[model samples]
Target: MPDNEETLVDVRSLHHRLVRINRVLRLAGSGSGLSAGTAAALWSITQHAPLRLSRLAEIESVSTPAISRIVTSLESMGYVERRADPDDARARLLYPTDAGRDVMSTARNARVLRLAEALDRLEPADRDMVERAFEVLSDALVPPEA
Candidate 1:
């Protein structure tokens, strides 16, 4: 078994690699023509719709003001819209318009195509190894059955 220090090093390396992969994929998908922040914020809003600005900020790990700016940009693009929060008159909820979903779909397809191109270059054995590794990682990341 690996020592604690070895385990830490492995985990840190994995984190950095994942971050780099995300960065590369973000750059690859240009169909939306959105800044990274705006794209991420829009994707999150779609995943969890009727989201509040505060909640979006929390999810994005950004200050409310910063997220507000991204949302404003999205609004200008006609990708997102703000509506009154019936439960709280003081707050507004964010929803992705039809255009936003279309943008996301285009972006997603571009990123996947990029990844597939890279995967296609791998040797059969190497590709199998990647698939097995992903399965292990996926299982490890999931919570145990209740």
Candidate 2:
């Protein structure tokens, strides 16, 4: 090793920059109409349709009030609809409307396009290596609960 070699601290600075970049990419996508949290809420409901609000809050690990606000916003935008639960009259079942599915699909496509373009500029071999590394990183990052 060269004398100039330095320790790979994997410091707080790197973590901060990584987080900032992720946020920037999220904001710079087809999600111009909705905030990030709202978009996440939409995605969650899309994945778990006819889901309950309490369950959604638990899955998202957010306060019930926060999820209610997001659901309210989604309802007003016609992105989601709430109906009485068939199993429980006191509870409600939430589902995305056609418009909501359209929005979710658009957002997913935009995010994929942006990421693909960014990786496309790299050499094919390098891209493959990075992709593999990302898979490993993803596996490592998943929490036990996930």
**What lDDT, from 0 to 1, does candidate 2 have?**
0.85
**Candidate 1 local Cα displacement, residue 78, angstroms:** 0.8
Stretches of model 1 off by over 4 angstroms after superposition: 1-16, 141-146
Q: Among these predicted structures, which one has the highest lDDT?
A: 1
Task: Please write out the lDDT profile of model 2 over residues 1-146, one tens digit for every residue.
Answer: 22432433444566687798687668656464898889889989999998999999998899999999999999999999999999889999999999999998887888788778878899999999988977987797797783
**Per-model TM-score on C-alpha atoms:** 0.82, 0.85
Q: Alpha carbon lDDT of residue 138, candidate 1?
A: 86
> For model 1, where is the 10-residue window of minimal lDDT?
24-33
Per-residue lDDT over 107-145 for candidate 1, one digit per residue giving the tens place of the 0 to 100 score: 999899888988899999999999899899989889999
lDDT score at residue 107, model 2, on the 0-100 scale: 79
Residue ranges of candidate 2 with Cα displaced over 4 Å = 1-8, 11-14, 143-146
